[model samples]
Target: MEATQILDVARDGILTMVIIAAPVLLAGLTVGLIISLFQTLTQIQEMTLVFVPKIIIVYMAVLILLPFMIQQLVELTERLMDLAISLP
Candidate 1:
């Protein structure tokens, strides 16, 4: 493939990665922020307190979003394979 074609593939790969990661990342971020705020207000300062909830919430988020994530990944893979087949 030409350099431009390679670059396009790379760009698409990055975008797919972002799209796939966005939900979990955003959920974790929001949960972390809320937990941080609670800690700041209550001044609990217990390390596991933050870790456990964040882990649970993230896991739950993953479970809830799993199907959608899988769909996007499958679609992206299909598109990528189509591109590969078309290349030669």
Candidate 2:
């Protein structure tokens, strides 16, 4: 592949990765922040307090987003295959 085509593919790959990961990451961040705020307000400074909820929420978020993530990955894979087939 030409340098420009390679760069384009790399950029697209990175963008797709970010798009796929954003929701779960955001869910974790939001849950963590809210838990932190609650801890601060209630003065409950248990170290393990944050883990369970974050895990559960992140898991739920991943489950909910799984279908969309799979679709995106499939589309990306198909596009990559098409590009490979079209190459010299």
Candidate 3:
């Protein structure tokens, strides 16, 4: 592949990765922020408070977003395969 084509592929791969990861990461980030706020407001400084909820929420987010994530991956794979087939 030409350098430009290779760069395009790399960029697409990265963007796809970010798209797939964004939801779960955002979910965890949001939960952590909200829980942190709650902890600060209520003064209930439980060590496990931040972790457990984030884990559960992130997991739930992944479950909910699985189809979309898989579809993105499949699209990426299709693009990669098409590129490969077009290559000399």
Which candidate leads the pack in TM-score? 2
lDDT per residue as tens, model 2, 1-88: 9999999889889989999999999999999999999999999999999999999999999999999999999988998999999998
Clashes found in each candidate (C-alpha, N, C closer than 3 A): 0, 0, 0
The residue-level lDDT of candidate 3 at 24 comes to: 95
Please report, in order, the local distance difference test score of every candidate based on alpha carbons. Answer: 0.87, 0.95, 0.94
Question: Over the stretch 8-84, how does candidate 3's per-residue lDDT look in tens digits?
Answer: 99999999999999989999999999999999999998989899899899999999999999999999999999999
Off by over 4 Å in 2: none
Predicted structure 2: lDDT: 0.95
Q: State the TM-score for model 1.
A: 0.91
* Candidate 1: worst-modelled 10 consecutive residues by lDDT: 46-55
Clashes of 1: 0
Q: Provide the RMSD of all predictions against the true structure, rounded to 1 decimal.
A: 1.1, 0.6, 0.7
TM-score-superior candidate, 1 or 3: 3
Candidate 3 CA-lDDT value: 0.94
Return whichever of 1 and 2 wins on lDDT: 2
